[model samples]
Target: MYLLIASDLDGTLLLPGDTFGAFTKSVIHSLNRAGHHIVLATGRHQTDVESLLDSQSLPVHLITSNGARISSACGGLALSEELPASVVRTLIEETREDTDLTINLYCQSGWLMNREDRNLRDFSQNPGFQPTICATENLPLSTVQKVFFFQRNKDHQALTRLQARLEQRLGSQISTVFTFAWCLEVMTRDVSKGNALRQLADFLNVPIQACIAFGDGMNDADMLAGVGKGVLMGNAHTELFQALPDAEVIGPCTDEAVAHYLSKHLLQSTALPA
Candidate 1:
């Protein structure tokens, strides 16, 4: 049976250093040729995810900004959930003095950051997908889809504290999830990969039970736990495994595990008792 397959970008589909393995590309192509649906659900801005895929056009749908925004294969925006402008401004003002945390805004147009991280532009064949350096006070809050708190040094403790603080302060006013140990993302209270995935399945008239997804981060938790088949990377965050203990743990992303698994199930023929 055909299925709708979704994958998270950074730690699930892409290799370290934000690169795609050739084997992954081949598998994606084969899956497409076999008529299965492919979707890339990521916390990244759609442009950033597009930068990685370049010209492949593998995904039938793109879930960007941790599900704040979703786009169809024709590059048309389908759904968008924006955070409250007042809340965005309030958080920026409150955290403006925190020097250790690098704040970024995934705006409707492009990525805006308080400081410049030049390494973010590496190897992207798409020259237009660069980060825009901006002062915290001048962020286009109304158009911002996601505000992310990034720990440049990858400090887990700092992230944990920040996560707690945000949850306590915002309560149900906003939603926050850690896309990576170093990156905590805040969005509209309704935003989540799982919610978006279910919406897409319904829009396309497909059953949610026929959808399978893969991920390796806390932001992926909702979708992983909600899908029919949830595959967690062997190298996924410890909390992720503990949270979804029943999920199928596959090999590490470094090994192109998603591709290998798809190859086995999609290419090889199935057998039944005669």
Candidate 2:
């Protein structure tokens, strides 16, 4: 059977300093040798993702901008989902009062933000990162998949309050979550990592029942619920684990538990029953 393995990047796969552990790399190589598929599903844009992979010389499919875009690392095939102009207009109007907050709009062309947001400027300077900034109102709305706010400090109370206000006003037409204390993402009502993973399954001609997903954030919830096997990081949130109690909870992403699990189960054919 063919296996599809998808995971989030920042807090889940790449640790502090944009590092990938030795065991994880070894397991990923083994999985690739076994013909399994590997995918990077992240809140980054295509350019940002491409540059990162290019720097590391790793080849994999990508689901970026919180499931708004899908592309192959081999340099072919791409799809994007964007909210309607009316929705974008409403979002901008809604955030008008919060000048201290920095907002970023993601589209096929690239990332956009108000140039005056110093925090945003700092974030864009991250290694191998580059984003295009254009007028938000003039952006091509059809290619957009998500909007995000980046805060400098890990102020949970501020993030919670901001998310709450957005939810109250947007109601069911929009979905919001904080992937990290510093980042809050808003997606279209129908967009999610699960949806993107399903799309990827179709593109790769694989069954949903044969796919495995790993994550450690609220954004990972739907992906965890939708896949055949959902694995959470041991250090994941209590509520996230409770929400998917039946799913596998491996050790923290940095611990090589995912590698251990794969080595013991999927990597060798002898593990399969006769």
Candidate 3:
């Protein structure tokens, strides 16, 4: 039996619609009814995810802040990893002089940004969200989960140059993933949805072969590449699709394509009704 279904939110499982399509919901319910666990792994923090859960009604065990934190839906916190205090201090010091970029920091408590950062200011206006603002130069030297560099209209050359520079300075000690074309995320080398999934799979006693993962961003690439069955949204970046040959490529989730594929190939023969 299929044992686990782990998917990224934002652009993969949760599309533009305020709600999941009926077929997708049914497939998810069917999977749950069959006793498989569902996990929502994303760059979002706990509060952001909780708000979405309340609006969408799809309860998920969360692997948030790109695996910096993990918690069950029924209210028990399980695991979390934080950047070393030294590393967090170093990162904050390195980026302060660069005013062209805005920084977002994720920690065990929640997300932090400068009060004047327009992007963050607008995001905070949305109800049920809980991000705190603090001075970049005065940020707490506590552990951090990830650091985001948010910029506007960055080109490939600019992004490549930045990534190359970061690699030269930090090497493999830091892991970087781009959740959106305009944003770059830096986390500890050992943290990712893939690593988190490995831990979750072990906890559930589910082999990799019994799992399927779906996603649409560069951050989702590693997990998609490593899983037994990976599904890439048709609208995902072209380069990402080329990097994972074994992944099942399908239409955009908004088209109900993911649900159709799951229902037709995975649940048709063995599902118990929701």
Note the Cα lDDT for every prediction shown: 0.81, 0.74, 0.74
- Runs with alpha carbons beyond 4 Å of true place in candidate 2: 73-76, 115-125, 130-142, 151-158, 269-274
**Top candidate (TM-score):** 1
lDDT tens digits by residue: candidate 3, 110-182: 7787545545542343356656778887677676888877664444556556667776777777888877676
Steric clash pairs (candidate 1) = none
Q: Across residues 83-114, which tens digit of lDDT does each residue of candidate 2 receive?
A: 76667777777664565566678776677774
Q: For candidate 2, what's the RMSD?
A: 3.3
lDDT of 1 by residue, 1-274 (tens): 5377889977798888777898998898888777677888988888888777777656568899999988867554488898888889877876778887878888878888898653344323345476778987787878889998777677878888987887788878788887766778899898999998888777666788878899999889999888778889988999999999988889989999998988887667442111
lDDT of predicted model 2: 0.74
Question: What TM-score do all the candidates reach, one by one?
Answer: 0.89, 0.84, 0.87
Best by lDDT: 1
Residue 53 shift from truth in candidate 3, angstroms: 0.8
After TM-score superposition, the amount by which residue 196's alpha carbon in candidate 3 deviates from its true location, in angstroms, is 0.5
